[model samples]
Target: MKRIARVILLLLLVAGLWLALKPTLGNRRLTFLPQHWSEYLDYMDFWLNLGAFAILGLTVWFALGALEKVLQRLCLMIGSITLMNLFLEAMQSSIPGRAMDRADIWAGLLGCILGIATGLAFQLFAVRKKSRTTSPQVLFLDQTGRLGGAELMLLDIAAARAADSEVALFQDGEFRTALENAHVKTHVFKLGEEASAVDKQAGVASALASIPAILDLVLQIARAARAFDVVYANTAKSLIIGGPAARLAGRRLIFHLHDIIADGHFSSLNQKALIFCANYCARKVIANSEATKAAFIASGGRADLCVVVPNGFQIPEERTSTAKTSALRSSLGIQPAAWTVLMAGRLSHWKGQHVLLEALKSVPTAHAILLGDALFTDEDRLYAQRLHTQAEEPELKGRIHFAGFQSDTMPYFDMADAVVHASVFPEPFGRVIVEGMLAGKPVIASRAGGAAEIIQHEQTGLLVDPGNADELAAALLRLQTDTAFSSTLARQARQAAQDTYALDAVQEKIESVIRHIAGSNKSQLLSPAIPLPKPPPCAA
Candidate 1:
């Protein structure tokens, strides 16, 4: 119905424009037109102009893809149509038998205002209909509100489902701001005291110490879940806290598993606890990659409830211009002759910034940029400081640059000759690998968990053994020395990323999983799951 309405509006717009411009194309007498300004209000041409411009304004409003706010869309339509009317009126004076009339412009302006008002009414009606029928109420829960890979992924999910979803954050930070900017309603739960960072290394005792705070958070989530049809746990901590809360509210729980629940990534205690919560509290579990799913099952998670659904990425709308890229590189003090490499992620020990620095020693001509900051705990901060100290060593001295915590990593990606991922431990999903591929850069990633799943060895990209600086250095040097091979790898990687990891594809899969859970009865939801067909290849 909306498409048909838009088509009709477009046809009307074309006819109106043609009618308004017809007289200006030829030498036509304007004797029928008003002789005075007061007479313009009574003239047929005045009404025609008003109707034409009104249609034009409505067309513009309907053609808009997505606007964050209704008022912003209305303003855009009114301003655009007003300027177009003024230009048309100005052109009348230059035409053979046409006279520029201020009254005509006023009529058009009035029409534009009316059109915007009409558009607002239509929007309100559509929103109401959507709320009543189409839009499902979803509650998204995340433990941390900070911007990390998982947090970024959660932002994308919330943005895609913003029409019917509300987000609940355990702690408030930049991620909450991102969700709000995307027009998703966000609520932040405050613990009475600062909560400890949730990490496997923190041990079960450390987590137990925050029991009071966790209980308070669980209560808040349960209350919020009651208003929503489905509760989505977007991270590890969220699964632990939101799982039981969802059960309490009698809401379907879908846990998005973005971690590898194995000894390499999580301690045995943390892994067992996560599996227990998922099996007992969650109706379904969506893993970010096959590796993540396998790890979860190996840790004794219920395989019947789990399915693999990889992270989606978007190709950059426009490639960075050469001039802008040069300017950025110059600002960063990168030498023009130097081959630049970028490693982007939070500066955690397992993420491998330190490993990248060690590898850089073998590639003397290549300059390295570390584009992230330590997040969460003081331990991460100290680890970052140690990396800084490591970069100061004689081998890496002038070649390594720590470009701390970039909110936007695209500029660095644009400036780099290649991108590297060198995690010492297994990753649940490596978002940076796909991002680099989307940017059309050759990626060299560790050959351990999800990164291995993303890069097809020498096919899509080069994969080195995790924690092996020698192999990483070799891959880097190969790219630097072999331009043709590098370009071929980049092209293939980009194609793979676009084909499998596009945002819409992943969102569709996730929505299907949620809908399945939401539609099922408690008995059906917990029954033995049939084996899911393998997902199409993706960067995860």
Candidate 2:
């Protein structure tokens, strides 16, 4: 038809102009072809280039249509063109007989920029055409009546504080109070009476009895997800409760994995449940370490679906406690002359406080202070009771002091000679070791899990075999008796902590990962969302 012929004619004319102008538009050899022809063509080239871009502009405008969502498209186009310019410049510098043409590069960049601006303008116009919509929301969920590691993480995150974070606790108790104190938005669900509760309301018994309460919690998550673009679950119980709700609300689900497993923390039955839900129910699992990521894969969870983002810290400008040094020492009833050894964590068996007590039998001149106690789930209260009994032993009596639980540990950290983490099990990420190092204190941690990853042997701090009393005693004696060696370790420890675990460096890595994920998401949206092709199977 006539329309087809006219389209062909337009295409031919455009091709002719490009072919005629190619040599002049490229390289610094502007006059190589023919002087007169070059002058004439160069002038024409400017307008032709403009026209080409105008056509490109029009094509982009048409492609976006009435939707008018232009910035993303503009960013895509401009970013692609900029990368190409870099490549061309590198080629010109490397290739023989080809000099870098600054003007041509600028022209190309200008054309790309103008094209992108025009696309954005069209998109802005489209936005004017669309109706108003609400901003997206975020939902956070945690189980247990106590505020411990996960609760502290959420509180610190909120206090920083990010926008659009809402926290809900599975059972209400002390954690609710702490959440309130932090000025964080929180909801507490009463699973049962105090007596029948798990750790007074933290258990499967309470969770099962509160079927109606669970349904309500599900409804809240569903509502929140509908309002938000994504629903992020901060606990395993939340994934059990919030994952289905998010799916029902047509929202994405993200799981934050704080716990690391090797073979036997959870029963096989529970592990199977975690693996199934992590693989099929959630869009992504954010693990705190590479070890955690590998564990997920080994446990039959999707390897590709896991992301590793280390937990970040905000180094306080000042230590948490302001009491005079003498007062802090006096509060623990320590004589001015005693060498104080401080341990700051819940006084539980797994924390290896009992082992520390036994280790103290060998390091006589040192007075040890156990700072934290009976925090988190009361499920460990019996273990704490045993620790209390061990501490009260006639011979061990006056040497050790149990300072129940203090919100601020910095004052104690300031007063102590050294900080120690003697965990029997591998911690996913031990903040205490990092915290101690940041305080410029010499640290001794068990050689286990993320602790091993963070501390360099004989450099940052000393690492002893976990649950070994004699090894811990030896490390204690070395720091206590050898002042120069302790000073050397302390100096190196602070430097490493600042260099590696400093807030900004960790944040930069997190930002890089997030930007990469965001870019990947955009790419997926641009391409047809055909199911990702199955990867080839490994040979037996």
Candidate 3:
């Protein structure tokens, strides 16, 4: 019915625009009105303009995409619709019987306001009319629909709880398609420029200035969250909106801390803001790594609120298919006997794609397949271009496969002999490292932060110093040179990953935390923390 109404309104808009632009009909008949209807009013044209444009504005509103329903977009549409009508009104100057009238312009403006109000009221009423019993049990909030480490982890968690939870993304991208592909319910509640302008590096003034946009998003999320038992924020940006929304909705909030909230990762002001929100709003903070948890506490976040939980990576069993692996290798131009190393992460300076390229300089004949794309910022895009240039250089030419972003990296993983984690800085929790382990490939991870905590030195996987190309190169050389040791490392890492980071086990641990927090009613100060499962004992 709504679709039919929208179509009729659109057709009415086109007809009305056509009639308004056409020359005035000379007394044959413009209306089927009791021909005496205009006898009662002197401003019949003004009323016609009002009614026509009101319907026109409503039509425009309904025509907008769901993500474009924010105030910024609405205002743009309203302004455009008004200007179009005014232009038609001005074109009246060219007609003999019609002249531009200020009254007609005023009527159009009034009609647009009415239409905007009606549309917004109808949307709000729809939400308010929904019963709490019918709402999703869990409302998961995420900052972006770009598949970063945090987002990938969130996808796994949300997919596991698809029957009871729904994810709300701040922006739209491939993440939505991933969710749909995984059979998980998802929605996009887009944030406009103001919300985006205030990033992790934003100062206090920038944050203060974005309050209006923040508050608006909060209200919307709060209204929708009233039915959910828990409001789970999947990223730092999500916390900015989810914290206040959860408070308003009177629901327990879970902050899944994916970042190391320290000097390099965030501005001092943003660090303070994150601490303030987590302390005040979150019932429980689920930190991805001990480094992340420690950083949160060091930056003034409450220690009692945080609990460390590793990211549960859902590895497809089919990634182990040797036939598919060989096909991928053939497609990517890896020689049958070439030693290929796989590095997967977004293209950013801190992620050290440059370091990997430099390391490849030392390991001359080794081929590297770089997965992931520049998902955010102009800087990253620039870096990506530079990488392409670097890849073309003499020592590295054709040896590096710049295989941009791959939705399912499993095939790429299957094609590689070893997986590398090359972040220049401390990773909060190395999702790719665990993924490498699960894929049954030898991994050489940066020896800092969660990567240090996950690998049991040379027993399970090799660890290299962060940003050291020589160390990375040497590890690459050793993995290629000593095939038996590499196979042993891969076997042990796979066993450890299977025992500790299995989907069902990790999901149940997190669900326990969620249930404990949600059922507490603020009675208990903290829920029992889920300890990292013991790594399987390794061979000598």
lDDT by candidate, in order shown: 0.80, 0.67, 0.82
Off by over 4 Å in 1: 1-132, 192-194, 521-540
Rank order (by lDDT, best first): 3, 1, 2
Query: Highest lDDT, which number?
Result: 3
Evaluate model 1: give its lDDT.
0.80
| lDDT assessment of candidate 3 | 0.82
Q: Which of the two, 1 or 3, has more TM-score?
A: 1
- lDDT of model 1, residue 443: 99
- The C-alpha stretches of model 3 lying farther than 4 A from their native spots are 1-136, 522-540
| Candidate 2 clashing pairs, residues 3+ apart or interchain | 68-123, 197-200, 197-201, 198-201, 198-202, 198-203
For residue 382, model 3's alpha carbon misses the true position, in angstroms, by 1.5
Give the per-residue lDDT of model 3 (tens digit) for 1-540.
458767887788778776776665443224444546634443477887787678777766666612212556667877887898789878978976677888989999888777766765666455445423333378999988788888888888888788889889888999999998889888888788777767778877888888888888899999999767789999888998999998777677999999998887888777777888888888899998999998888887888889988888665656557788787888988887899999999988888889989999999989999899998777789999999999999999989998888876778887899999988889999988888999889999999888898999998899999999999999999999999999999999999998888877888889888777755633321222322233222111
Clashes of 2: 6
- Summed over model 1, clashes come to 1
For residue 5, what is the lDDT in candidate 2?
37
Q: List the residue pairs that clash in candidate 1.
A: 372-405
Output the better candidate (2/3) by lDDT: 3
| Per-model TM-score on C-alpha atoms | 0.72, 0.67, 0.71
TM-score of 2: 0.67
What lDDT tens digits, residue by residue, belong to model 2 across residues 162-236? 454567677777777777777777776543453223222233555456566656767766776655445667776
